[model samples]
Target: MKTSAADTPPRKRVIVLIAAGLSVLLLAGIGVYGLIQGPRTGPPPDNSEADGPAATAAPEDGTQTPGRIVPVERSSDPETFARNVATAVFAWDTGAGFMPLDYTAVVMEVADPTGTEQAGLANDLAAYLPVREAWVDLRQYATTQHLEITDAFVPEAWATAQAQAQPGQITEGTTAITIEGVRYRAGVWNEKPVASEHEVAFTVFVICEPAYDTCHLLRLSELDNPLR
Candidate 1:
């Protein structure tokens, strides 16, 4: 007695099921990441027992010090900053073939120069670079086959990012650090090229660092908005 063709199970059946399952999971994860805005900021107050007379000492430049937050104001030329940002933008690959770990930044040109505050160059750079960087890698994990594409951020990239984003968020962590009537804010990020040029962009915010630079993404967002 020997086994025949009818005795064998279909190999394609299992493969087909796995492929379909992967597709569903990938789509679901993307939806969750984008749609779910997570928790929200609420309420205010509690400055009564906040202790002693607050010091009005400023950094002489503009940024507020002696607090959890600080406004970034160490930016020179937007064009040059963009170049430095490019190094950081592509520091970490997005796993997609379009942007792999071995990606490089090729500056085509810079557009829309936003200042260091409230939706300017600095803000946009921070938002787009850092967050997008981690997001890109993390996204690929839940992408399809759970293939962990060699995710690693390079040094030059990180340094370049720091230089470009740091100046934006003077106050690393606070909301609306008393400033002019510009309603200015700052954040830092590690953004990637916006699909085409691959130039680093920043996001602007109204507050300095969200959490003492713990949340340095406001810069990236600010860099993206507001006419510098």
Candidate 2:
């Protein structure tokens, strides 16, 4: 007979609980603060100008060139830390000799030190980067991408979430900032450079100050699904 979820081993049960909690956090913005509950196209090559932000050409030997991977700069200020995290999330080059996970690591380096939120944060990062398969496809085109941030601010809804939370329901120093920016992607097509741009928005949650000397990422809202 099949074992029921309730009858699962203790270790397996904890894993399930963590996954369930992460899902709730990702899907519902309120769950994240309430309980801690928590693309593409255009332009010809412009050889005369700089290759685009973080852009790099694939190696001729068919070997991935490990391009420079810049880790997010840590900051004590919540807004500054959030902005850095947002930039790192959207910055990547398929031809830069790195996979999506490498870029993910850059941001994860500043994730919750307690490790309680790392798994959830990883899931959150996955939604922002290309999967391995897609990365390979884009690599063929020598594609590169980065974000041009227009604004970063604590959303009003965050205030509401905090007010509604029972004292201690939310971690002290934890806050949410909505990031507004334009995502720019550039690549070579038919040996010509092409580029495209789209407005994007997302919320970054972090804990700073007494939690740690520098802000640490906790979670992220769904892409273009940031709190107003």
**Per-residue lDDT of model 2, residues 1-228, tens digit only:** 112334321121112322444544344454333223331111112221223432334446767648679989989999999999999998988777889889988889998766777887887787777767667767877888899999999887677655655444565667788999998888776667778787888888888765566788888876777766
* Residue 24, model 1, lDDT: 45
Candidate 1: which stretches are off by over 4 Å? 1-78, 95-126, 129-223
Cand. 2 TM to true fold: 0.75
Candidate 1 lDDT tens digits, 1-228: 111334322212111222334344344332211112211122112111112121111112443222221122222333224223333333332223333212212211222111222233232233333233433433333121111112112223222222333232222222211111111111111232111111122212222112221212122222212111
Query: What is the TM-score of each predicted model, taking all chains together?
Result: 0.19, 0.75
lDDT of candidate 2 vs native? Answer: 0.69
- As a whole number from 0 to 100, the lDDT of residue 71 in candidate 2 is 87
Alpha-carbon shift of residue 102 in model 1 (angstroms): 15
Each prediction's number of clashing residue pairs: 54, 10
Worst 10 residues of 1 by lDDT: 176-185
Q: Could you say which candidate leads in TM-score?
A: 2
- List the global CA lDDT of all models: 0.24, 0.69
Best of the candidates, lDDT: 2
